[model samples]
Target chain A: MSLQIPDDRTPDGKPESEQPQWRRDFPIDWPEDNYISRRDFTRFLVLTSFAFAVGQTWILAMGSMGRGEDRQGRELVASVDDIPEGGAKTFTIKGTKEPFLLVRMSENTFVAYGQKCTHLSCPLIPQPEMGRLYCPCHEGAFDLQTGHPMMGPPRRPLPRVRLEISGNKVYATGVEDHRL
Target chain B: MPVPEHLEFFIDPNRCIGCQACVQACAECDTHRGYSMIQLDYIARSESPQTVPIVCMHCESPTCAEVCPADAVKRTEDGVVQSARKPRCIACNNCVLACPFGVPKMETPMELMMKCDMCYDRTSVGKKPMCASVCPSQALFYGARDQIERQRPRSRPIHRFLFGRQIIVTKVHLMVPFESPVAPMDVIAAFRETVIGHVFGPNFSAETMVGGGK
Candidate 1:
């Protein structure tokens, strides 16, 4: 795909190869406005509940089997001097297409966060002068220091990306998922 | 007034080719990032392939805003109904369920209710929405009433809709067949007829549903 980031729907990703244009680009998986009987609605709810239970069981099994696995390997992001104080640089980690923002607070203090906003996932624009990250889509904002939402519709804090500085280089360790 | 005067949005379901160009262009709109606010719906998949593009009607009295417990949804003086406010929206999914057009969507990841704001960012600056701009069929139009009438002479724009006993007047207009006296569409009655017809087959009568026992 030309875009490092994919859109909401699945990208055809075919034009690059000069493939024939398929008639339908947007294919909705779920039914919209389709009629459902009372029995069907009840069955849907029951199935959803069972699916959640199965998901929990699967997670438990995966946790047991994947214990001690280093899922997030250290990936070099940028150097301290690369980003000026009160400015941010964007980068992506290995095996993930999502981007992250690394903002330099001072010569010593630096923080990183996932670029996607907590609300609606519009790419968050770093407003270092204002000491916050701003989402233009809904005017959502997050604190620069803690990633907690300071203003707008976003209810949860931006996921903080763990950073490790060694020598002149900064490395992204893993994302500290604080979404609750 | 956020939305400037003389400019309006029109939806003519008849012209929709089911190509989803509106949906594609909407996601590409600078305001929404990659999210498309327009919903493409089929009238009935079993019978025909007729499709409708549903944008926020931006009602005079928005049901989505009325049902919002957190007061997240806001309508400007210009009559543009905005997406739910971030800090204020509780993600209760009230707007999603309450919207007659099924416009507002609850993003599970973001826990926010988002819908078409008529591209308020663009529209406030006097630009057409991305969807309307790219529609090959002109099914979705954003322009003056005079221009639309000249182009689609047989089509009349209606902003009023009836749901059961309630009448909703919207900012956005739906281009319908031109008639002498355009009545507000009775969505509930039409829905009742469709549902009853499916259950009782073709021979069902409207009077029977109202306890006339014909």
Candidate 2:
């Protein structure tokens, strides 16, 4: 059966031959035409709404699955004496290429955070003398103790990398989800 | 071809590196008194380290100038939109509310409307604006329209924009990726998927929104 609909115009309307160039180029029955009936448009809208729901559901499922996997892994980053007091060491996570910094603030205290500055993701430099993490790109500074922004542009605290110490070994447990 | 006497300033977001050199240099403008008008917005620093700088577009029919009840905002002969004059400014935020690009800010304590003037103090004398001069990444560039277009063929500098029903022609040009022209260009729709998110996103860190914690 032919899918093309018969055009019975030209009774009072413009004749087919005399129609505008745009109308001729894009014929009423063009195969790939975007035109659709009101019912079809409504149906397409409903399908689109359904598709968005399904996509969001899939994302939610994937996010939950990823979170479960995240809780299972713990990577050893450095030893207790690997970094001296008032020093910093940079290391990548086991599966991720992103680097994290470990700062030994004092003899007994060690803190770790994502090396990317909160301002613009420029690599941060630990200023041991000034007791802060500094980003040279924009003069962004973060407090060494709490990893909170203390000066310049950065407002968000550096994403803290959860750390555990046992028997002279420093273990990077997991990244804390600051959002939750 | 001779360069146009009134050269148009253009910015390419693709080249921006988020260094904030432009922001620091803007403070050096003689009249602004250490208040920088340039804003470096992090597009998606969490996902990627992309940034786009925001400055006054200097529209052909400036909404700021039109909305100013006290006749404080003025456009120069060369088309640079000046900030609200301190003496005549009524501290009414009509210009701030009317600006489609969200470029103006009301300094509450000072009771004055302030925004990017394209460094009129320097540009009037044929000098480059502070931001364009200091931008290390060359994201902010100032040159004649013909020269700039010739140098960067991949991107086209566009000043005319169609937003819904309004047609806005700007003095400052935005470098947009080349696309076949078939209809009136909607700059807002183009920005909606990219620049708008960075500028208007709720999750934007406070520092990125307002530089240096202010």
Candidate 3:
């Protein structure tokens, strides 16, 4: 019984040492047994630093990309009678779940606010008596008039969902943001 | 306004209604810049306690800057400890560990460090910090150290004393007497006696009060 040894050819029909050129210099200068080099470690640290810097640069770039918006024609939403003045409706626009409240501050006027609480994504409930919107999950409250927080855990004002009137129908055309 | 030497936020508990305005403002600013400045945490330490807003206190001597080996973090001239940028970070958790407030965080995968700089950039440009600007209750304020100190609730105690401690007072004050029935003649007599007594008292009241005041 004779024992035979196999050569260093990879099972995939390629020489084990003949990988792509990019990999040739990699492991850069790994010693015979050790898997990494000091140079490689330093390079890794430098690259990490570069990555951090690049992340900031990316942020500046994104900020300079400007805000995403378009001034155009309006879109149709619920009818005037559908919301019943001091009520809310959840709808999706541009693939985002935007909940808005339709408040009848007067007989002929309507105000709407994004229903999501600014605190922790809780849904806001209307407190008509208090003229505020309350979040049951966290007791967060927002003013119905300016969408500012009246009390509780909400910090930012509710993004005012723009509403356009088309004859007998009320439409949410877009949102007006005060955030810088 | 420039931040002070010691970075302590004057939280007006009276003005705080638990509205997370500062939280959303911070998150928005962070999202705009593609970084995380502030985040809302819902801790259930008590079964039914309401979630409260928390933010970086921006300490005077920041632990984040102390522990950063790469020196990527630094306190700005305006007293904000700002990270150079996300790409400058080395993914070391030293800053996170050094922060006594535990406000700094490093996200997974890339593990980039992130924390608040008190919106120093925005403030330097004459805009209010994101949190202070977005506060619906005007709870958060930004200004020069002195201005903020002045704007702080007036009820805080004045802990400083004027002049040296070796001064002594030779005079004393006496109560004045009133003609009304609620007042007494002894009070007036005591006042006159004290007035005369203080003029001839053991300590130098006139000199001491003068230097002590101004």
First chain of candidate 3, TM-score: 0.58
Looking at model 2, residue A99 earns an lDDT score of 82
Query: How far in Å is the alpha carbon of B135 misplaced in model 1?
Result: 0.4
Give the interface RMSD values of the models in order. 17.3, 24.5, 33.8
lDDT for A83 in candidate 1 is 83
TM-score of each: 0.49, 0.47, 0.34
Provide the lowest-lDDT 10-residue window in model 1 chain A.
Answer: A23-32
lDDT tens readout by residue for model 1, A1-180: 111222211223233234333212211111221334467889999999999999999988875773333338788999888888887899987876878899998788889998998788899998888889999999999999999999999999877888899999999888877655
Q: On residues B34-100, what C-alpha lDDT tens digit does candidate 1 reach at each position?
A: 7888889877656777899999987765788767776567666576777876766789999898787
DockQ by candidate, in order: 0.01, 0.00, 0.00
Q: How much is A115 displaced in model 3, in angstroms?
A: 94
In model 1, residue pairs whose N, Cα or C atoms come closer than 3 Å (at least 3 residues apart or on different chains), thus clashing, are A152-B86, A152-B87, A153-B85, A153-B86, A153-B87, A154-B86
Residue A168 of model 2, lDDT score: 92
> Cα deviation in Å at residue A133, candidate 2?
99
User: Residue-wise lDDT of candidate 3 within A130-178, one digit each (tens)?
Assistant: 7888899877788888898877877778878788887889877787754
Task: List where candidate 2 sits over 4 angstroms from the true fold.
Answer: A1-180, B1-6, B180-187, B190-214
